[model samples]
Target: MTKDIEQRLKNKDINPTAMRLLVLDFLMQQNAAISLTDLEKGMGPSDRITLYRTLKTFEEKGLVHHIDDGTGTTKYALCMEECDADHHHDLHVHFYCQQCKETFCLPNTQIPEITLPKKFRSEEMNLVIKGVCDQCNPD
Candidate 1:
């Protein structure tokens, strides 16, 4: 796990610190996106301030992308590209299951393009689709 984190950070030109490595390892372990609180809980009793700073650094380096699902909780997922700082891949849709409240990335589904008003520049996009997941649906 540590090796995986190291490789990911090295690929992104990010120096892998202990905290950052642990955080990235945790994120990689998850099958879906995770919230800050979830990450903290997974990391045991680490300092909240440090975690926040680490997350901020990761976001700036494009190691992770934020996902706001309108659930009042911001989730994050690992970025697919090492040098994707300027080009975020959040254009993909996210599936949020209402029953389990888990968010899964719909890898094959691409987000439709939306025209912006004049003089407006779009940097990144966040599209979340809410419904029941297979585990929750059980059908």
Candidate 2:
């Protein structure tokens, strides 16, 4: 697993330092978007400043993308294989569980293509549906 993480870091032109490897490994293992608070707690005895920097670097390199689901806090998840340092193609629907307060990426359900009005420019788009998650709603 460590070797795989190292190779992935190299592929992104990022140095696989101890901290970077740890952060990347954690992100790779998660199925939902995680906030810094959660990451810090999950990563015990880690340097907060270094961890923040590592996450920032990953975001810049497109290894991960931030999800601003109107929570006033940003969550991050591993980007899809289609993403790169220059381009991010991880524009899928995000689900925020109101009960658990967790964020999930619904990659199978894509965002509908839209043609905007003339002179109206759009840069980035994020659609997050808020509700109880499957785990929270045991029906």
Candidate 3:
């Protein structure tokens, strides 16, 4: 976990602190993407404001990407490419399980490009597919 945090910090060219390390470790431990609530639950006694600030910093540094699954919850996943402290890879699909309500990152799946009206600029795009996950299906 420590190594993972160090690697992420180094990749983002940021000096990792204890809180950052802990947050990064928690994110790395998850098999799926997670929300701020999930992070708070995982951290136990962590301060909410502190966690939010940490997440904001990580997002700004491009160590994480925010994914809105359209369930009134925002989740985050680690960037696939070696993103710089200011850039991120925003073209990926997120999977949300209806039964478990957990979100997973579809790493190999790429989000299709959509043509927008003229003069429209797209900085980021999120595509979420909701259904019962394999674990929930099990049939």
Candidate 4:
């Protein structure tokens, strides 16, 4: 498991240090997008600064992508296989559960392409569907 995690980091062009390996492994184990708080609760009693740095590095390297799902906190999830250091092809819909405050990447749901005004230019885009997820929905 550790070897696989290390290899993933290396594949992303990131140095696979011990702390990076540990954080990447933990992130891979999660089923949903997570916040720094979630990671701290799940993977720590580990170093807070190291963990933050690891997450920042991953985001910069396109190993992961973050969603500002309007939950008052940013959530992060693993990027798709095609993501790389140059560009992230993560134009998928994000589902944000209001009750549980968990975010999920809906990989099958592609974001619709938009045509901007002639003077406008666009780069990154995120489409988040906010609702009560199955886990939080009672009905």
Cα lDDT listed for each candidate = 0.83, 0.90, 0.84, 0.89
Candidate 4 residue pairs that clash: none
lDDT per residue for candidate 4 within 24-130, as digits (tens), equals 88899999999988898998698878788889999999999988898788888999978987899989999988788789999999999899989898977989899
Which sequence of candidate numbers ranks them by lDDT, best first? 2, 4, 3, 1
Model 2 Cα lDDT, one tens digit per residue, 66-134: 999889999999988768889889889999999888999999888889899999998888999999999
On residues 21-117, what C-alpha lDDT tens digit does candidate 1 reach at each position?
8898888889888988998899999998898888878888888888888899988887767336565654688899998999888867899889999
**Over the full model, what C-alpha lDDT does candidate 1 score relative to the true structure?**
0.83
Query: Which residue pairs show collisions in model 1?
Result: none
Report the number of the highest-lDDT candidate. Answer: 2
In candidate 4, position 129 carries an lDDT of: 96
Greater TM-score among 3 and 4 belongs to 4
Index of the highest-TM-score prediction:
2
lDDT of 2 at 49: 88
Model 3 spans > 4 angstroms off: none
Error of 3 at 45 (Å): 1.0
Misplaced by over 4 Å in model 2 are: none
Question: lDDT (0-100) at residue 63 of candidate 2?
Answer: 90
Q: What lDDT does candidate 3 reach at residue 119? A: 100
What's model 2's TM-score? 0.94
